[model samples]
Target: MHDRDQDIIVCRCEDLTLADIRALIQKGYRTLDEIRRISRCGMGPCQGRTCRALVQRELQASGINIKDQVPGVFRPPTKPVTLGSIAEGAGRRSDHA
Candidate 1:
């Protein structure tokens, strides 16, 4: 592959390159979940929303049928909740009750 293609960013959230993905595939990382877990590809703020398709495409190109592959597990973003907010919400609920 050309250097330009290698330089292409597959996962912008994690700054992972196409070359990185290819290397992982060559190393026998077949499932999307495996790749994500090992490389943190889909563990970024955007989750796998951005890179999932791109990585899948790569996997397809490498002769892996994505349909049968185990998909990566995406966790919901963790939002920080202050204790004050929780207490205020509880107070409001009590007032309503």
Candidate 2:
């Protein structure tokens, strides 16, 4: 992660750079909530499964308080499903795997 290549991509959906996030952290934007609100980090399709932890650690290294930082909520299904994927007649899929 040396130097983050100076131009490394961070939030791939929004095309935000590590440099941009770091600059935000260097200012007073000290929480994941704050970062997301202002910089739009984890509001993308991958849903922070990739970038959330990176953003969290980066902010923490900058002295942010993450213990109470309030990561986003997880709603039902918790996995993606298309409406067509739902079956009219169904027993749930087996867990045999």
Candidate 3:
């Protein structure tokens, strides 16, 4: 990558760049949760699967020891859910009502 083209996009899913993360860090958002909540960095479809490590690296570089920090919340059902199943469940719920 050329010097001018060296745009470090930490979160492609949320379009978060390195500059964005730095600004958040400068703003006293020390923890990943703070950054994630304010910038929606990890709330994309991939659920930070790709960006978590990058973000952690940035945090560590910023002098924040992330060794003890929880990487991020990962709920169950890691795989994607189908819309058809959602519709089926909704129908079942309505029937019970």
Candidate 4:
């Protein structure tokens, strides 16, 4: 593959390129879920919003119909709370009581 193809960004959040996707497809990865589990392609903060279609396209190009594959699942994004912050909030609530 050409260097230009390597520069085509498929998943910006994960820094994955089109070439990377193609390589995975060539390696017998036929489903979006398989690709996600192996490469964490659609498992980033955007949660497959950006790269799902791209990966599906690659799979289709490799002669795999996406309709037969298990769909990618996106989980709700969670913001991590620090233990100290939780403790502080609890202390404030107790003091008010």
Q: Which predicted model would earn the best TM-score? A: 3
* Candidate 2 error regions (>4 Å): 1-5, 75-97
The predicted structure with the larger TM-score, 1 or 2, is: 1
What's the ranking of the predictions by TM-score, best on top? 3, 1, 4, 2
TM-score result, candidate 1: 0.76
Which candidate gets the maximum lDDT versus the true structure?
1
The 0-to-1 C-alpha lDDT of every candidate, in the order given, reads 0.86, 0.74, 0.84, 0.84
- Candidate 1 clashing pairs? none
Which ranges in model 4 have alpha carbons more than 4 Å from their true place? 78-97
For model 3, residues 1-97, the per-residue Cα lDDT tens digits are 2343248788888898888888888889988899999999988888888888888888898899999898778975586688899899999999999
List candidate 3 stretches off by more than 4 Å. Answer: 1-6, 89-97
Question: What is the per-residue lDDT of model 1 for residues 1-97, given as tens digits with 9 covering 90 to 100?
Answer: 5688677998998999999999999999988888998999977777888899989999999999999976766564354467799899999999999
What TM-score does model 4 achieve against the real structure? Answer: 0.76
Model 2 TM-score relative to the real fold: 0.67
Backbone clash count for every predicted candidate, in the order shown: 0, 0, 0, 0
Q: Mind giving the per-residue lDDT tens digits that candidate 4 earns over 1-97?
A: 7789799999987899999999988888778988888998977777778799888888888899888876765564354467899899999999999
RMSD of each: 3.4, 5.6, 3.7, 3.4
